[model samples]
Target: MDEAPKALQRFLAPFMEQLTQKNLGNAVELMNEDERNEFDRLLGLATEPVRSFAPYTF
Candidate 1:
């Protein structure tokens, strides 16, 4: 995240915070289509393994 551009970091902050707080549903619900797409793309770039317990209907 520290390596991300300022604007990108700012754009993702709220969703990242929600995820950190374990509020997946809220984060998903709050994202518009574009946001959701970008988030999904970013998730693919994660170095560490990621897991999701619930299916997201994006």
Candidate 2:
């Protein structure tokens, strides 16, 4: 992120905001069953929970 320039960051700000806050269900309501299934599958990958581990000290 440090390498990303301020201009690019400014451009991405609004798109990122929409992505974080948009309701997936509302956006997918018009999709056909197959399209909906594909969306669900992809969304599952993105939403998968990451496991956290406690820090180990030397």
Residue lDDT tens for model 1, 1-58: 4343454556667776767564556677779999888766665554435456766755
> Candidate 1: which stretches are off by over 4 Å?
1-11, 16-22, 47-58
Tens digits of per-residue lDDT for model 2, 1-58: 3333444444334444656455544455545787666555655555666667858843
Q: Candidate 1 overall Cα lDDT vs. reference?
A: 0.65
lDDT of 1 at 49: 54
Q: Score every model by TM-score.
A: 0.46, 0.43
* Candidate 1 C-alpha error for residue 21, in Å: 7.4
Steric clash pairs (candidate 2): none
Q: Give the range of the ten consecutive residues with the poorest summed lDDT in model 2.
A: 1-10
